[model samples]
Target chain A: MPKPSPKRKMVRFRDRAKCRFCRENVTHIDYKDTQTLQKLVTTRGKMLSRKRSGNCAGHQREAARALKRARFLSLMPYIS
Target chain B: MPKLNLSRVYEAMFLVDSGDAASWDDLVKHIANILTRNGAEIVGITRWDERKLAYTVAKRKRGTYVLAFFDLKNGLAVVEIERDCSLSEKVLRTLLLKADHFSVADMRLQLGEDIRQDVAQRLMTERGETAAVVHAVVSKPTHTGGEPVLPEPSGDYEPRHERGRRSERY
Candidate 1:
């Protein structure tokens, strides 16, 4: 693995970009939108943290809730 | 019942046993009634996907999904609805979630954009054909180690007790 980042800003410009939903101006992250949530999950079926998703605190919380809801409903797999 | 709901948008996806009714419409209606009976104003409902489960549920290995968007008049009704869904013989599982501020058009779009049905239908048809092919292959005598071996289906196909009782009846 590469050396840990000394500063989050020093990370790749594309990696620390603005939140996804924020760019679209979405208030409520819809859990029923499986297609969108599927992209946010890892191949191993793990949730990416806000730091990784580059989401603001609010959007991160919404995304977490939506992801958990989708998993409970079997709409999304818990593990790939 | 008292109406306490602020008319929030809610979505539920139910896994219904397709074996109960092969007709898609009948399966959709069967699941919709469970929500409608509890005063849920359905916005849009559509067939989601059909496939075998990772594990059997209620002795059913295969099931299909019905995705529904509705408004709850009473927030507490969700718990009751979930209970009813669990108790229903036709419904294997149900997931209920609060989808606040989702518009009718958004729900309509979801219904239209769900493209799992066509592929699942084709898979279901293929499953039937594969089963027939397997049956034919097993029925025919196959050469094994220079000897023709016949399929011993009767001994393996059913439980011993059930087969014993069935034989007694005959």
Candidate 2:
């Protein structure tokens, strides 16, 4: 039998366990609060995915809705 | 009597040219007329903001936003109000939203509150500054003759002795 190749040891970094909104206990996401929304979007004006933004599924949905509304009012750009 | 519970609250934002905002009182009344004409009760109307738009609408570079809250019994009233806004020359854009989530008190807070001052203060605080530097610039000053005069240069005005050299060069 061929000798088993050496298993690479997996190294773990600092724990990123909690979503940002969950950690802060945010109940509502306001589109008028552009500062917070800007953090959740990429530089290109595209929304970051759940995994990238670390937002819970519920907050992510709310953020998406707010972003769309903001875009319609020209509060946020549709494309950068 | 018609059902009292049929009316629902709504939030609307109207975009108008900043130049035309000088007649906001008349504009607000016009908007109220439109809403009341369609059986909508006006809760409040306020100047929301005056700012540079991210994109121009109706060839207007600067826009003044008017925020209004109202209660409407029929959903079709929204369509009629939208039609009126589109037909009106004063209004550039209009956005109507069902605001069932907002309480009457919260709606009152939004009315007549301009957030620009708050934003400026927040930015100053974020920069580790305690006070705001407000410089009021008057572009034109009315002279005693009642004609507008160009404002004096802001900095110390040292008469330019070098201005005569251009004539010598000719």
Q: After superposition, how far is residue A33 of candidate 1 from its true place, in Å?
A: 2.8
Write down the lDDT that model 2 would get.
0.65
Find the candidate with the highest lDDT and give its number: 2
Error of 1 at B59 (Å): 7.6
- Per-residue lDDT of model 2, residues B3-120, tens digit only: 7547677878888887888887898888889888998877777776676665667777667778887778798779999999999988888889887655443554566343234433
Best by TM-score: 2
Model 1: DockQ score: 0.03
Backbone clash total, candidate 1? 0
**Relative to the unseen true structure, what is the C-alpha lDDT of residue A76 in candidate 1, on a scale of 0 to 100?**
63
Question: How closely does chain A match the true chain A in each prediction, as TM-score?
Answer: 0.78, 0.78
